[model samples]
Target: MVRAQVLHGRVLDAETQQPIPNAQVGVADNRLGTSTNDDGRFVLSIPPAYQAARLTVALLGYRSHTQALPPLPGPELRIELKISPAALGEVQVTGLVEGIVREAVARIPRNNPARATQLTGFYRESDNDTIGRPRYLVEGLLTVFKPDYRQPGDDGDVQIRQVRKVDLRPAGQAVRIDWAGGPFIAQFGDFVHRRAQFINPRHFRDYAYRLGPGSSYAGRAVYVVAFGPRKGNSRADCEGQLYIDQASYAFLGAEWHYTAGGLRRARHSGASSRQLRVAYQPYAGRWHLKTVWWQTQARLPIGPPLNYFGEFLTTAIDTAQVARPGYVERAQTHDVFLRTTVAYDSAFWAGQTTLLPPAALRQALLDQPRQQRADSLFRRRRTGADSSTVGPAARPTPRESGRLGFLGRLSFGAAVGLFPLAGAGGELAVRYTPAGSGFALRGTAAVATPGPALATSFDYQFVLTKTLALRLVTTWLHGQFEGEGWQLGANYQRNLRPGHRPLYGRAGLAYIRQTVAYPVGTFDNPDDALRVAGTKLGADRLSARLQTLTEAVLPTLGLGLELTHQFELVADAGYLLHLRTRAQLQLDEESGFFLTRSSATINLPNADVDLRVNNQPTATLPWQPQHWLLSVGLHYRLRP
Candidate 1:
């Protein structure tokens, strides 16, 4: 058994940024939970078994907050709760559909099982090739602890009993999903915890509801409600079905996906197509999550004539309908996803109920990174060599470190591919810096408001050794209007006092020339303008400037207390001084230097919120347009 530690924290209001008293705190599952005193402070002891379980806090009139507990000797903990704007049955009840949803919300605490239980879940996830052939597959039996719904179901600890996978494609050609994300994507099916946005009564009128044909679940009739964004409201539309029990008005099951209006944003964010289906089972008169299936397809534009199509298929089934009376166990010591470092046990799986893949697929699976990640765990444990760096605990030395490590290494990290799909346009980025050298090469691929693009840069030890290097940059932006850049510069570099984060700093000067690029008011990156259709630029636009750049990166800062090896929450500070020698730059010429700051921000791992000041650059700019940029981009890491 692992050793347990005391987790202490404070809760505060999001709006007021002040302490919140009497807030409830607990382990993701209810091994033990508590309420904060008047000062919004509380302390809870973790049992040795659940060191890896999630920690969550909740209070009425506020949205619930949840996060995975960090590893031992974690940083100080603080939680912020946003004011819940739930309509709370305050909607205009002109129709039966809206009334039903309101009633369902009211009856949730009762119909929902807020008790201790365990689940024997049969889980399967797969990825299909461009032509729809199975390319990757994973099947497993998960023994998940079902926590109280009063908090979040994911608060429950889960352990894998038996697992297996299949991959039919070659390593270089195979489509891969970040397995670290696999632990939580399944949680999306728990609508109560995942889909908190659409439930608010205040937003009820935004959807037009219709009653579909009634259906039977476990011999009980369920009221089917079909809802979507109202007519003429294409951009904000969401289309889905709700399965409610007729007598209890209990939310038995739910199914939802975006409509055509939602597809525009979805397609560019990764998947060109997708769907979700979930079913709940009833036992002991209380509803339980039964099954969930989510399928998605994507065609990523790597380069010209290199369009890659990939498919994802996932299904889960729960067997332990409900817990026996007074069922209890220790808090989860380790989460199943990050633990379980053993290899494929043929005999063990042979006897268990598992979805076995074809022989070639199984052999192919052996070559995937996931297989390495799974096997890596116990190997490190056996050697007592655990690392708390950028990679997983069992990470091998093959991965790089420091700035070169950050730039050279290719890692498809811990990002939940299921989210950040809302309003982000599109993006793709990769940086390469070979080992044992002062030379670096960086590149970015993106589809802005425009169609597509490719950007790259090269640098060599120019002065003061590798600490000061000479660099050259170039870009090819393709959209409605094409653009290009050529720049030559020198850079000074230094590494920050080292810790868990490999912080670094750099200052540079360069001669730059660009055409059809965004002007001052927005961000400087030309790729920002590339959308699905493409970017547009006016003719005769030219820029010749002497540029000064200074920047610092603090990759260790984060808001949520989740123990993740990936760069979940990080911060970067930068300053760029562009002195226009040709045409006057907009904002830089207008008034002040461009300034920017963004934080508290554990929104999405791969997502970015750029705030460009007049002295600074936003995610986008108006070269000579009227305003600044507030850029939101969604990135899908197809490869390391």
Candidate 2:
């Protein structure tokens, strides 16, 4: 039979001299435990077998106290545990300082099983060097009021909100998502690696011996320790030191630095880099991340130029997609900052497991968005600043602004020689504007190269005003037989309407130069055929087009039907004018070519001749005075 003794205890706040109800009391080794009632009194029953064992007392947001009990007869004993605010409040720092923190943290066992928890507390964070003023020095309290609960059949829902100075809003916003997920356990485990990383005890076995000695800060005794990668191990992204309370072994603060060496290449063109920082007095005993302030800088090597593959003309048979063959390498730098805080309510921690009433949870979730909007409105009302407005009173915009935009098409209708007859190409554009309307210049280069052929183009567009636009476009092409060309045109657009859907009309004139090589014999070898064509082929083309455009229909499905008429005066000297008009069609909803270009041949040089260029008198091919080009395709406006 087991002999036992019962002990009684009362927990009280040291500063307030008030009893703390619902305080937890338990044996150090056994699971036997009970909590104080409304009167802050607890009765603990211990077996005689544990006469020499210690008993631990704890309360939410309070320091845990342990004491050994002497052998006793069947009698009720009384004990008192005092709450120390400083000892009960501190954040957990992993990595280099984890050992020091674990000494104090191990004394407290997690009693609350609820995955979701709301913490409300004040915070003060700073750097370890103390060179300049702390980055986040403000003191404020926050409440989760609503914690996200992931129960069976529950919808994925997350709600987070907080209030702080405009300057501090960024840090607050960064953590709101984590807080809504519940307590820091999930976020902590996710951020800190428990395997061979920071939080793993196996990896940090030598930490205690390496810590060396203790130190003092601001008259408060603190233990200082440094950490680095173990011998035979490569350098890691993180390194840091911890400051612990020497007396209670509690973690007072910590400073850590991280560098993603290889990851830097993934960010941008430049040399890879890393960062360092410190966090102080950010949370209470819950090991909650209060506030973290870090500064990081990186250097990345410039990367190779982007390769875009796709088609240019949506309609055309035997069209090739073009690719931009250029290289770009650049270097960049960046600075970042972060902070967070948590609050706790003892009452919420000492309760039975029960689903939060639906009505309460609903109200809590809804209140979050409303609070954020209210905060925004309040700030605008208080500051009287409307950033959307323009004019002399508006905020000045930053200099050096540019945008990169691209469009491409790739499609195939059928297989040829076990390979799809596909085409792909894309365009790249860069623009610069010193002022909104003054000296705006834009440059564009595009290429589409498919099997057996390639087409490339370059264009420059200059907008002098909201109503005037000037453009110059030129193209060069190469195919199985060889071809090249250039076109120059200018258009002026005048807006007829100003609101939501604006209407505009444009007119332009174009001059084109083209050349094509034709085979003279049945050349079975491609290289031999090319050599023969180059030696005996006739190639020449000079064309001028006067065009008029009119919009007849426009609809929401992004389908626009426009009528265009162009007068083409062709000067094809001697060679046949192989006028092949084609269209390549693709559906916005699916992959693959939906339609091929409608083609009509208007043969030139009515009289056939044996092509010995020197023997044929220079002759101009049949000229067509007017040509009508109808374009029927879907053009969807991208969603904002």
Candidate 3:
């Protein structure tokens, strides 16, 4: 059993009475905390041991507040914080901004912890698609170890403890955001520690600074300094306000957004705009990172801009008895945090204080898109319990099994083959499935080579149980030869590797019908044959199309593996039992009937010709199809 006290409330400004979003709410003298959502609403879960501790609320440019809890499971409370009058007047006096900024930069080693510290926190990152719809969300409980503030180039390491991936895109759509090292954004965004960009003393000359009126953050009087690119400066296109504690020269917090010039420069790299906020709180003689919030736009050259939002709230900080994570435990700089394979822990998540998304965002995450709901109509639902059903009594229908929806079920595949047909070809396929039912129907139109044949197939699939399926398929081949084939097969499919991007395998065997056409003798053009042999011929060389129908029953074995979610990469191989075949042809003319008695040799390359007969190959013609197939391709699918 798990237990935690639930404290819920809203934070508002006392003077204007407006909701204060992103305000930090935590327990006094401890690390547990959460941030207010867009609407300034917050819910914090505290352990029973912290019942006697006061709740502390703080936001940049506002006075801090600490109050005792009213009661267990109490009513929602309101926290109103006010701006300091003295700080307001102080902003009007804009002098000494540069001096303060310089002093803060020099005092970083003194204000921040010089030794390594491990911080345990909650990290959440959500991204939207080109159309601004939610693409996906990732939340994790993380342990990060930071090097000393005095270290110049060492970025810290992160060990992911628990993570959950929520696929919110309307099914079947590919999310293109790299999203690698998302957690490092919080670690690397510490400008005071990294001393880069606007905060670095070396680049200070590139920016012009001004003092905004005074302000207070975390109950400390702070000097609000605003900085922008100086005239004729091209170092960086950044402009923002920074909060520096007046007494300790410590940075309280900062808010920054890209300038127009910066955006223009970023456009070259596919980013349109970027904004960031970093906040810190003083504790035990050193300032500890409290939270970092960031939002950015990635402007795709071909689609709507993608928007991303992320937050890292320091829930617990351990300055003493801190140790760095082992090398294998540390998250690499290129690793995608959301794709980590750690299992979800419901109890841990339930006990942690998580920042709730806005109501609209929450709804978007829970409900399917209208098109998706419409597609679900085609799915068959299970009725009363049936003992014959192979899977669980309560399993999602085939249509709902995959992370993607209706449009995602339609896919185009390409593969190379070595038997029957010996060239590469592509196929476009559409699949339909019933809700709660394991049955599915698929249709495909394909074109392949050696003979460059056009083919079509219809497939029926019944999932016998979770991870296993039986399929019956029929196909027709045309173009160079007219033929038909069929197969009865079953396959086993399951996630071989687990992560945000999953990998799966499919292996099956089938009783297959193999059809192959053998080449017959070439025919001469009627005009040329008449001139050369003094006889009218039944066919022209160029127009003479020959085909033979022969088939063999064989057992076929196949295997396939697919990786990733939206656009999947699949590799496949097939082996079939070989068989010897005989061919016979057909004729449509009296002349062709009489020509069987005559013998002639003809050269007909590039000749205009027509076929009066298409027959089985003579005994002298001897060529056979190979017995193996292999291919690699990219496509989408209704995951089973």
**Alpha-carbon local distance difference test for all models:** 0.45, 0.32, 0.63
**Model 1: residue 588 alpha-carbon error in angstroms:** 16
Best by TM-score: 3
lDDT tens per residue, model 3, 1-640: 5467888899999999988898888885746777888888988887887877888888766788889876878888999998754444333434457887888888999999899988888888878765545766678878888888999588788887878765544334454433433677768677777775788877778899887877677777777889999998877668999988888889888889888778777633566788989888766788888788888877776644668878888887788798887644666555565554432323547767777677777666555343344344434334343334332222222222333343323434444333455533333232223233332223333334354345455555565666776766566665554555666877666666644334667676777764543223233333433322233333434122123333444444343444433345655565656444443222222244554533322221112221121132122212244555444555444432
Q: Model 3 TM-score? A: 0.57
Off by over 4 Å in 1: 1-95, 115-118, 143-147, 152-162, 172-181, 196-198, 235-237, 264-268, 303-348, 354-563, 568-640
The regions of model 3 sitting more than 4 angstroms off are 1-3, 15-17, 88-96, 130-132, 174-181, 260-268, 302-304, 340-348, 369-374, 378-640
Residue-pair clashes per candidate: 34, 29, 20
What's the CA RMSD for each of the models? 22.8, 22.4, 15.2
Q: Considering lDDT, which of the candidate structures 1 and 3 is the better prediction for this target?
A: 3
| Predicted candidate 1 versus true structure: per-residue lDDT over 1-640, tens digit per residue | 5555766677889889888864556563433455554467765656667677787676544676778987655665889988653322322436677787888877776887767566555565655544434444445666555665666535555555565544333433333333222433345556754433355566676787777766544334567788878777664535788877677788766667766666676534654555666655444566556456566555555411212221111112233465422212221222222223333444654323222343444455444445556555656777787733324432222111222333332322121101001122234232222233232223233333532223222223234353555545343333332344445665555545333333335555556554333221222323222211122222122121111121221111112221232222222222223343221111111113324211111111112222222334333322221111111112111111
The TM-scores, one per candidate, come to 0.41, 0.28, 0.57
